[model samples]
Target: MPLPELSISDWQDAMAREKWTSADLVEGFLAQIAALDSAGPCLRSVIEINPDAMQIAEALDQERQAGAVRGPLHGIPVIIKDSIDTADRMLTTAGSLALVGNHASQDATCVRRLREAGAVILAKSNMSEWGYMRSTRPCSGWSSRGGQTRNPHVLDRSPLGSSSGSAAATAANLCVASVGAEVDGSIVRPASANGIVGMKPTVGLISRYGIIGVAEPQDTAGPMARCVEDIATMMNALVGADPKDPTTSRCNARPMVNYRKMLRPDALAGARLGVARECFSGHEGTKGVIETAIRALRDLGADIVDPVQASELPFFGPMELELFQYGVRANINRYLSTHPGAQVRDFDELIEFNNRHAADVMPYFGQEFFELAREKGHWDDERCLHIQSELRRLARDDGIDKALEKHRLDAIIAPTEGSPAFAIDTVVGDHILPFGCSTPPAVAGYPHISVPAGFVNDLPVGLSFFGAADEDAKLIGYAFAFEQAVQARRAPRFLATKS
Candidate 1:
């Protein structure tokens, strides 16, 4: 069997049954990567294969030999996004050539947790250069360091990003599980594209101390997996408070651990679920699939409500999409400064770097947003504060909260993205319908999970489950039930012919 067809659970059970060793699994994935990466439809998802990956796997095998198991991820191979910091041999470039040979002095909070869980950091996956904020060129998995990552389903289609490679690789089964960060649609969009499960935990649920930041308010790390249970398995090991990130102090104040034990497939049997009508006016296929899901929820004994309204939305209108870019330029530059060997240390330096490498980096689009972010003022500025505040209130306090209150709902359901993979193009930016990752839980800093909804044209579509801030458990429970009920996940063929 191909390495790309195995799931996290598949590998875990194999290792426990002694059917396969950790070393064997790592070697299988690496061999599969070499066979399919540059040729065989060429889904160039991996940016850098960790030099010490096998060594780490050997150590995990030794521990297993000693009957010293860490957990479900005891010897699992995992992939990290380029934006994540890892104090290892792999470069943390955030997919930017500017940081081509950089190294992190420390691990990002989630990476540290993965290590503590005994998971091997398999490789650095490709990304939208600088988490897709480098330009508006619809880079989708294309990075100056690693070139474009094709959708495994259809070689010519786009694997929607920022976290494009992470989601694509997981769907292609390049790793057992993957960690991707979200500002807006980075995690969910690609998850939708790849027919997999993606969990964007509440912004502070998983610490962000060492992640390359985009928007502090919206930035978060999440688990990308083949199933909701796999997501839970990974998150159980990753979620916690880190003193390095003050945002995690909230979790420290509570001190809870092991979320998987709390999961129940029948958990949604008595929960309140809302349908956010405001988010789906134009997406007919998405609307149909979600309605089908709502019917299944009702069969599962859930109380469903329609037309839940979102309140106090931003006055910026469509300009709402660009708000996070300003946040990314400000925060990513600060983090890059701390990474030695990175070519660009600041936004000014990035623009200068792009200017110098225009032939390679700007072969498609200019750094328009980076220039605009350089012009924006401090966080306290009235303009920045007012819009960001409104974004949160609408997504959170007034919107999701209001719906939950009025309908007594426990969670909400919507489409994670407009549809499956579209044609990849550097000339045009994302062709997303206005209905995706727009409201629901994104702006609210709440928990949202996306799993395979269905397909349009052999391309995967995803359904999103959203709930209140800190309602991560319930949302996961609901998603797990839905995934079991629907069973829609399909492996990419990587066929000799494109769809």
Candidate 2:
């Protein structure tokens, strides 16, 4: 069998058994992309396919034949969000038309690691324009260049933003796995909606070099896959230090551990899990599913701490917005000036370009956020620094850290998102619901993982496991145990819409 119905281990076993080569696996996925992504469902998940994917895969197959396997991800096909730089033929536009001609001179640090592990960079997945930092009321997955990426589970529903394509493609089996970035709900929300596993590792666990940034404080790229085991395997490949990103220095200080070895089916036993009840407010169906998930955890020997005030601190949204505005103005300008292949050089020029081509770029919504970024003051302004420091303190020391310490918990659990994928509405923008758990871990720069918990009327809801900084391995173990117990994930049928 090809990779369409196989996990990473299964595919490796198949290849070892000589059932198929890496080249054959790539061809199977390319066929699936053509059949489902471009024609059948027209999910628009992949923005662009790497033309040299087959050649890369064939070379990896040759390596395997010569007894030169690199790692667990050897010959595995992977897709990365368009925001990541590949230093290849594909454009890194972050789903915006303004940077349509831009290309990277070198791979993102994470991409380099994946390549070193012998993974094929199969495609660049579509994302929210500028990772949803373009407009105030922008549609989640709508991009001028790649168009809107619809939910694989339900075609008319939203796939969430930024990491939308990564999750959607993974759920639809377009690739073995995909990498997605998250400043907030981008990774997990889409994964929840698409019924896959998405992980947002502690910021600095993976290098951010060559990725288009929103805010350095919250931005991090992570693995999204059909199983938590695959995510752990990818984590082993992705975690590393890079001099280009100073935040990554923290990772170098810590001793490395094999994440895949951390996965245990009985990891949940004797673990104390706290539930942030705040996230249980929205969507009665989702709440019911989370309740069932909690029961399952209990049955599996976990001590559940009901109603933990982990996210009691507020004002993070506004504070983060201020930081994003400052960071975007600084980060994008720095990126454009340094990247020789960039079409637009600065935020002002990008705005001018968008205005000039509004019919194409802003047909659905205006670039208010872009305009806001351009108008922000210098990055080192006292007010900006104050907000930045206060945000970290509140979100870290007073928020997640406090909760973990007070309850003596291994990790906090909650619904990954407020509800299932909302309607894909460009005219009215995204119907963002309330009571999400992404912000706490996002702002804390802590590790968070979303595992498919259960379904709500056929729409998938995820159980989020998040905790203190550098607790990624523990959270993954917990998530893996929960995943094995619940077995909530299933391949999407590409239903036209909800009746």
Candidate 3:
């Protein structure tokens, strides 16, 4: 039988009914990957397929037959970004060649949680080299190890960076769901561009141990799937305190609740949504799409606060760079020192390695960001500390919190990205249109969700709903309500070019 859309619930129902075994499901996905990922459209999304996947699936099927089912995710296939460590046959390269032969000593905290929940580590998705922080003008989804990950909707258009492969694979139904890491637009923008649901939970909600570092202050791992329910299911497995990552300790004070319970179609009836007008001033097509979404929200009984002015936080832009530069240098050095079998021991070594292998690593774009990061002073420098503190104050105290308080809003809404997918330009680099809603929440380490809003031309765009810190469940409910009302997500046709 042909596979359905394969949401978490659908997959579970099929498995419970014995319509397909875990092995069968794994084989189906693997076949699809072979035909579509790097063969048909040359998506180049999956960097490495898990060689032990079949064995794991067979074991899960045997366990299920003996009535030892683990949970909703038992035997489900999940694609994880290459930046996340798996400790198995797959290598965690962060889509760079420098870390090619190194194997992780253990699974990342999130990966371990997924395993405990009975998820099959299906494959490793490609990502922007070093999470798109290596160059001044980086190409979205272009990685040294895996090449370019193309958007399924239009093969020529970009699958926006960093988490590009995860979003693309999920949108194309190559897997039931995928895990992605974010340090700003990495999760939401790609999810939006690829027409899928992406959630960036509060920074501490998911542990970062074993994942390649981008910035400690803002980096997080979250779920990317075709629907909010799948995202919630993945979230259920990923949240917990890990001794390896101290940030998780913050979550212990407020333990995680099942996010699936919060998905109510009537969730918007009494919700108040504030529109961040700043994020809407993008392409006219994108603006119109978001305007239609606003109308849908209003029709769904939501109180709409149009043109909410929340983007004027002081030092919002500059301080983000300051924190990222300092944090990446310090955090990566710490991670590299402890990571097993890593060839490049520090930022300086990584730079030298890239320079030596410039033919492969710097074929299209140079590592200017890495060079600049190396020049940054220590994380505890007076200026760095001040910028970090001020950024938090402005983004949280004076930005999202202030807006919500003034309007008595449940969440803030904005266009997840500016345009759908720009044409891939390898020579000059990605022509990223000035459109995204990742900054305020990212800098504040708050929760953010992106849902498919509508299409612009033949490409997909997303509507973002973000809330104050630790409000992930509520945001999920709000986004689910919006998703149900809009019913905007559509399967990609894999068009050869934009219509």
Per-candidate local distance difference test: 0.79, 0.89, 0.89
Give me the runs in candidate 2 sitting further than 4 Å from their true place.
Answer: 1-3, 313-316
Clashes of 3: 0
- What's the CA error at residue 48 for candidate 1, in Å? 0.7
Better of 1 and 2 by TM-score: 2
lDDT of 3 by residue, 1-499 (tens): 3356868888888899998888988999998898889788878899999999999999999999999999999999999999998989889889988887879888999999999999999999999988988888899999889999999999999999699999999988899999999988899999999999999999999999988877788889999999999989999999999999999998789966999999999888989899998776559889899999999998989999987866564222666776778887887788788775778888899899999999999999999888888999998899888988888887888889999999998999999887778888889888876557888898889999999999988899899999888999999998998998889999998999975
When 2 and 3 are scored with TM-score, the better candidate is: 2
Predicted candidate 1 versus true structure: per-residue lDDT over 1-499, tens digit per residue = 5654565677777888898999988998898788777566689998889999999999999999899988789889899999999998888887777777788888998999999888999998998887777665556888878888888888788888788899888888788889999877789889988888999998787998888877888889999988888888988888888888888777876657666765676877888777766666465666777678778888888888876775434322444555665687668767876776676677788788878998887777778767777777765567777878777766777787888888888887777776556687778866665566535466778888988878776778888888877878878888888788778888888754345
In angstroms, give how far residue 59 of model 2 lies from its true place.
0.8
Measure candidate 3: CA RMSD. 1.5
Per-residue error (Å), model 3, residue 415: 0.4
lDDT against true structure, model 2: 0.89
lDDT of 2 by residue, 1-499 (tens): 3355678888888888888889998999999999889998999999999999999999999999999989888899999999999989999999988898898989999999999999999999988989888888888888999999989888999999689999999999999999999888889888898999999999998999999888888899999999999999999999999999999999879999799877999999999999999776658888889999999999999999997988754322677888888988887887898786777888898899999999999998999988888878988889888878988888888889899999999999999888877889999988877677888888889999999998876788899999988999999999999999889999898889895
Residue pairs in clash, model 1: none
Looking at candidate 1, the ten consecutive residues that score lowest on lDDT are 310-319
| Structure candidate 2, residue pairs in collision | none
